[model samples]
Target: MTPVILTVFALTYLGMILGGLPFLKLDRTGVALLGAIALVATEAVSEQAALAAIHAPTLILLFSFMVVSAQLRLGGFYDWAARRLGALPVRPLVLLGALIAVAASLSAVFSNDIVCLAMAPVLADLCIARRLDPVPFLLALACAANLGSAATLIGNPQNMLIGETLHLSFPGYLAQAALPVVLGLLVTWGLIGLLTWGRWELPAGVPAPSVHSDERGPNTAGHPEPGRPLNRWQSAKGLVVAALLFAAFLFVPWPRDLMALAGAGLLLTSRRLHSRRMLGLVDWELLVLFMGLFIINGALQQTGLPAQAVAGLAAAGVDLQAPAPLFAASFLLSNLVSNVPAVMLLLPLASAHPQGATLLALSSTLAGNLFIVGSIANIIVVQAAERRGIRISWRRHARVGVPVTVATLGIAAVSLWLGVGAP
Candidate 1:
């Protein structure tokens, strides 16, 4: 049973890294779902255990926020934001700064991937219309979203998981993360501005790429209709709800999940927007992916192999419970398997150390900018750009991503070590 469980775990993670098994139609989500099914069929994990393994708080919180994000999207808040940012009568570098600031601030409270998804297409079109190269702005959108999300536990999925499981002080974590995140965002802006210096437009006589839009792909961005005006009332409603939720998460003793769920319910009971439309905007695939990974990871933990591996590593002086080792490992594994799975794998180790949660959150989130596939936020921005015939190749992305990642991680490590005195 142990070997069988290990096999299932290995295969599932392999799928996660490869985005699916070769010669099969499975994507990461599909592969994850199938892995859970295999474990159940083999009886390595009982139904009762499986049910218990699912973390209700995390899922509820995640689902509730998706509804909230959907409301903002449908309300035209994100579109309005992009237009307003692009319309500023400022130089390209200043406009780039504004883009980074807006993206990072929004992502601190909302879903980073959704923020990128909503902003990318509109930004691409805006750049094309203005005769400005959209590549740097698009990259800034992805990079800032990932960086800003590190500011708070609720900023990204992995951060939420860490916060909920560890029961770390929300305000405390914010204090620890705020410095690194702010610095990181600035670093991202500087790198992009420097790299694209004086090359902010396409060559003469070359027309801007035609922007594509359809309802086919996941949350596709179709061509914008003329004068499809902003719904101020709806936008205000979402903003107020989101602001209140942020306050509650920081100050109130109430469970964050319940507060978020209440917020979602308020938005759902709207008089104009249909519940179906709002729900349709939800990323159901992401929800399924989380649940599947939870089940598979839970089953593997039951087999005790993880504990054995930890002991073996500790024997070689690679103790994960220490902040320095965990910090380095989190950065590496996050770039390797992406952040969520990396966090899940190292979470148990972080649980025993005082600074483990802080180290995990900062390192994992910041490390995502190291490569395009290091975070879902990056993937969302890249895919959204590609849809509009604006290509951001891996080489192009790494030029900005690599230096920004290294600088931010160093800043975070030093800040954490100085503040927490972790070795």
Candidate 2:
């Protein structure tokens, strides 16, 4: 049984690293799901044990936020915001800063992936219409979203997991994370702006309509193909609920999961925005992935091998409980297996350290800017740009991602050393 669990765990994480197995249609979600099923079927983990491994609170909070974000997407708030930013009569660099600020702020409160999904396409069109190069803006959007999400626990999936598992205070985590996130965004803007300074204009070879053209004016180009028009009432309702939930998270002694669930309930009962549309936008695949990873990881923990390995490492003078080593481990593991899985593997170590949760959350998230595949928000923005005939290759992404990641992680390390947001 131990051997079975180990094999399953190895193959599952390998799938994570490679993004899938050879000669299969499986993705990370599918791979994770199959691993959990394998564990249960082989009796490596019993049905009851498997069920117990699934963290209900984390899943509920994630689902609730997905609903809240869906409400905003369906209300056209994201599209409106993108177009408004694009239409600003500011200098190109100032516009870049604005885009970064907006992307980061929204991602801190909403799902960063969803924010990218909603804004990227419209932004691409706007850039093309204005004869501005879209690549830098797209990259900034991805980087900002990732960096900003680090500021709040509910910003990304992994942060939510860390906060719920560790029972970290929302405000406390915010204080710890705020400096790194803000400075990271600033670094992203500066690095991207520097790299693309004189080249902000679209190349002559790239085909795009002129800003003065009647057929593809800035206003028309920035507006995404008519989806849901902005519903002030629905958007306002979602915002109010989200605000109240945020307040409760800060002030009340209630369970964060239930508070979030209640907020989602309010959004789902809307009259104009059908529940089907709102629910349809939810990332059910992500929910399943979290559940599968939970079960598989739970099985691995039962095998006691991970504990033994940690003990061996500690004995060798590489203590992961210390802030510096933990930060390094979090960054490497996050890029290696992606942030959520990395956090899942590291949470046990974090449980013993006073600042484990903060270090893990910041390092894992800030590390995501290292590559295109390091975070889903990056993928979302890249894919969205590709659909609009704007290619952002791996080499292109790494040029910005590498520096942004290094600078942000440095800021985080310094903040942690200074005992900011220390629990």
Best by TM-score: 2
Model 1 bad stretches (over 4 Å):
204-228, 420-423
Question: What's the lDDT for candidate 1?
Answer: 0.86
Regions of model 2 farther than 4 Å from truth: 208-228
Least well predicted 10-residue stretch by lDDT in candidate 1 = 211-220
lDDT of each: 0.86, 0.89
Cα lDDT tens digits, model 1, 334-402, are 988889989988999998777789889989999999999999989988897776667789999999999
| lDDT tens per residue, model 2, 145-241 | 9998999989999999999998999999998899878988888899999989999999777655223232222334575342345668878888888
Clashing pairs in 1: none
